[model samples]
Target chain A: MVAPVAVVGALFIVYPLVKLTMDAFTQGDGGFSNFAAVFESAAIRNSLVNTIVMSLVVTVLCVVMGASISWSIARARSAAFKALLWAALLLPFWMGVVVKAYAWSIIFAKNGILNSVLDQAGVIDEPMTLLYTRLAVVVGMTYTMLPYAVLAMNPTMSRFEPEFLNSARSLGSSRTAAMVRVWLPIVAPGLIAAAAIVFAISIGFYVTPVLLGGAETPFMATMIGDDIFAFFNYPRAAASSVLLLVLALVVLGTALKAVGSKALKGGIAG
Target chain B: MTHPPRKLLAAAACALALTASACGSDTDSGSGSDGSVKLTIASWGDPFTSATREHLVKPFTEETGYEVDIVDAPGKFVANLEAQTQANNVEWDLLDSTSGPDAYIAHDRGLIATMPDDVKERLLEELPEDAVTDFGISWSVLGYVGACNAEAVDTCPTDTAGLFDTEEFPGSRTSISTSPLVNLSMAEIANGVTIDELPTHEIDLDRAFETLTEFQDASGAWWSSGDQNLQVFESGEAELGISYSGRAYGLIDSGTPVEVIWQDGLYNPGFWNVTEGSDNPDEAWEFVEWIASHPENAAAWAEALGYSVPNPESFDFIDEKTAKTLADFPENREKLGLMNYAWYVENYEEVNKRWQEFLRG
Candidate 1:
């Protein structure tokens, strides 16, 4: 049984990855020129920077917002309320990514609901520029990845002992102090897991940024797509893909190591 | 322990089956035992395929007892054709393409079949010489025109130059970012050059980008898709934009208070070409011939699509008011400029790199 599973894995996953790496090295007159070209191209460089920046921003936002929601849901007394919260959190995941991106575009449009509401409320004389900005890209990405963060952190938050917070409070800790000194440390493993997953997913975001963002919001995945479909430069696309994979793996591995596997496993198991 | 060995055997058998399936080809021989012919035509998908099936395919199948299958062929047309040809298992009998350097490239690579002499003569007589190549025949034309929300602006842009003149007509503007052809061409026009001079005048990238940067600063969005263009206007993101005439017309028809300027418009035509090594070349030729001969069919198609057929006879079938909005209308045709596809194909890689840099900047 192990032999068959290994054979399948080798044929599909390992073979493609090896072929891609070889193609990246050998295509376009061979050598590491493809990697060189990736670094040299200003467009690709900008996309690289943008991808890293956007992913980091999105990960931070998802953690903050997702942790708050998860904590609230976990502490809620009503099962009905908890169920509703879970449904709301998982709703976006149920929808297609492209559809969600387009929906965000509508909501963020100049005359969209947000602007229209703001305008009617006398909040501003002119419509705010909501769509086609880095802010919009981050917002869309966070919305899409928030569910994963919530799902990751919810289990841990539910299993969290209120005694820790009470004990911190008994030791002369304020609410904020209790949260920072006790609750946060106790939930640190889940937070790290959530951040790792969000960052990994956000780094490869293609549709959200494109549909909701402006020209300045081009991400690494979009560049890879353009390289393959528009430019038909497979070698460059492969090189970029490999770089993206390495970046994601490094970040995820570092986060997992920092959190400690025992803590992570405990958090998940709980 | 016994279960492990059985599972391993099952897995191995499954892997072998998957490998065998992957190596198999999806080839369909044209001839049936009952002597009927079946041909597969690659399409760009609905509603083009849907319209073609309803108007063209159904009629052809009824008139001639041949089964024609319309399959979705979305991206990298030439690459797919080459791969199939190399494998000696060509699946498609015909391919619908935009009449441009791509069709010529396919012809050069011997991926598309050459038109018979009589068919070629008919297409030449109907369409402009440039529109009908030996390997392809122009079916319909779509125009890129200046579009504006009429309700928002008192004075509409009469030509492409007015789109860049923000001082006179102030408000947000948008254009496509994926292809540089329309934007660069319009920029050239805005810089006091006519479409006629574009063939000889080397495209000045610096000048184009300078103007484009100014426009981008003044514009609210840079759309990448047709749906986005419509959204830009409908949602009031941009007061003015350059978009396909069909999209602009759709907006007008939907009561968006938008107008499409036909003057100095850029036009791109669609083509119908038979693929090389088709199992039913004779039936494919017959289908192409039927499409060319029936202008009414093309007109119905163009009307449904909000575009124009290359066959001028199509006008007789469509209403007069609708005909006036078409790309190939006599009045609009005079003001229209055809994109230099040959130049684009030759310089696309370099031009696109610069275009990407400009877009990023």
Candidate 2:
């Protein structure tokens, strides 16, 4: 049953991908024209760079923050505290993306709750421009990815022997040094897998960037969407989609090699 | 209270089949029982679809004894219809709430069935002459006008040109960020281009872009969808922006402090058309006429939906306070300029590329 299902799934994927590849090349003026258009236009190139840079930022934020949350949950002495940490990490998973984006809009609005709180606290004289900016996009994207990153890293972090830290410290090493030398290597696989997941997921983000970042902050996903929906340029959309797919595959492939497929799968499931 | 395993499985299968609307409703519905013919019309989705279903579909189904299912296609109506037409299996019987140029494009491409002389005569009796086309009948009106969050800003732009007067108005402005036509055409008016010069909504690209860049500079939180339009205003992401009359008025009803300005506002008619190879053309056309003739129902719908009915008689049933807010109110109509979407559709490629570039900037 599984073998047949796998074959049918692979066939479904292969057929569409083959058609899309043909359309990408043949639908443009000629071979590679769609790709030429991608490189030729400064706007498309800008979106490509923006998507990459934004994903990088979101990934870094997710990793550092994810690690801290995972460590806290693992190191918690009380069951209630561990559960609390777990609950907080899983909070975003409960809400739909569009709802989260709208909620962020309310919080980041000019006269919104954040501004009101800041004003009451006398933090600033005027409301800063928060909504519809690159910064807002980063904040929203990172908030979404942090939960997944934590989930990915939690297993590896939690399973580690706590006595190793004491043993390293007792062996005449400083706390920071022991952490750097021992703890780093032990959890590096999960961290790498989490980062890969966050980065890949961030690349495909569509709604948050549009709602929070507005038209000015169009991501690569937004660009492809415009080609398909707004402009109805299927070839260009296909080309961009192909490029994005390749980018995602390359990232995942690099991570899988580093962590090994089994370890990476185990890390994610945990 | 639990059923036996076999009984439960049968019930679950029945539920699944009913929920999947396309299961066999596609082919067999044409000859369904009760002699109440089933017709499917492609709709642009809520809140337009909500209003259409309430005022038009429900009454038509009750009066004429025909069944109607609304499919929300949004901007993909023409494209999807074209695909189905090519496949020799045209699914939708009617294309409801098609924008003005979309009707023209579909008609020009021979995608929609031409209005038979008899149907034309019936439609013309209820709707005006200009409103009745060979391929489409004008069903409703849409206005893209300047609107302000009344509580947010001290001043508002009275005319389209004043929208560019950032220092005088003194607030973050926003507008439709997706289409070049809305911003660019309005910008042309702001840049001193007249309706006479731009009868087809064509823009002097150089002049329009300058004003557009200025407008972009002054604006914050530009919107792409109707929900975003309300979101920006409700959250104060924008102080004043170009907003649809329906949404802006709906905001007022919902107790959001939105003030719509009609002077130099852009307007367009929404069309109702029958697809070329529709399963039930007569039923679809009958539904169209039903909507066109019933002014009171139109009025009630407009009251509920905050859009204008094409029929002038709708105003009589509509309350004075509500009438002022409708898109086709004489006073508001006088101040509004009809958008020339034919020009926009003709130059869609250039305009869309320019729009993408402009937004990226």
Among all candidates shown, the one with the greatest TM-score: 2
lDDT of 2 by residue, A1-270 (tens): 999988976777678788787878888685988988887666788899999999999999999998888888788887777666666666665566778888898899988999999999999899888999999999999988887788777778877777999999999999999999999999999899999988988998898999899989889988888876666677788888888888998999999999998657865545
Q: Write the residue-wise lDDT of candidate 1 on B1-361 in tens digits.
A: 0011233335434543674465443344443557679888887777878888988899989999788887776655676677678688888888865445467567766889998898788767766676677787776577889998988988988898898899899989998877687788888888988878765556787998899889988988888877888888888888897988888888988879987887777876777889889888878888888888888898898888776888878899999888888888888877877766667766777888888887873
Q: What is the C-alpha lDDT profile of model 1 across A236-255, one tens digit per residue?
A: 98999989988998987897
Candidate DockQ scores, in order: 0.23, 0.30
**In DockQ terms, which candidate is top?**
2
Candidate 2 residue B129 C-alpha distance from true site, Å? 2.7
List the lowest-lDDT window of 10 residues for candidate 1 chain B: B1-10
Candidate 2 per-residue lDDT, tens place, B1-361, comes to: 1111343335434543463433232232243466658898888778778988998789888888777888878877777776687678887888877877668778777889998899899888888786788887776687888888778888777877777778788788888877677788788877776654555656677788888888878887788988888877877778887988888887887888877888887776788899999978887788888888888898888887777778898899999997887778888877777666678768777777877888883
Which lDDT values do the candidates have, in the order given?
Answer: 0.80, 0.80
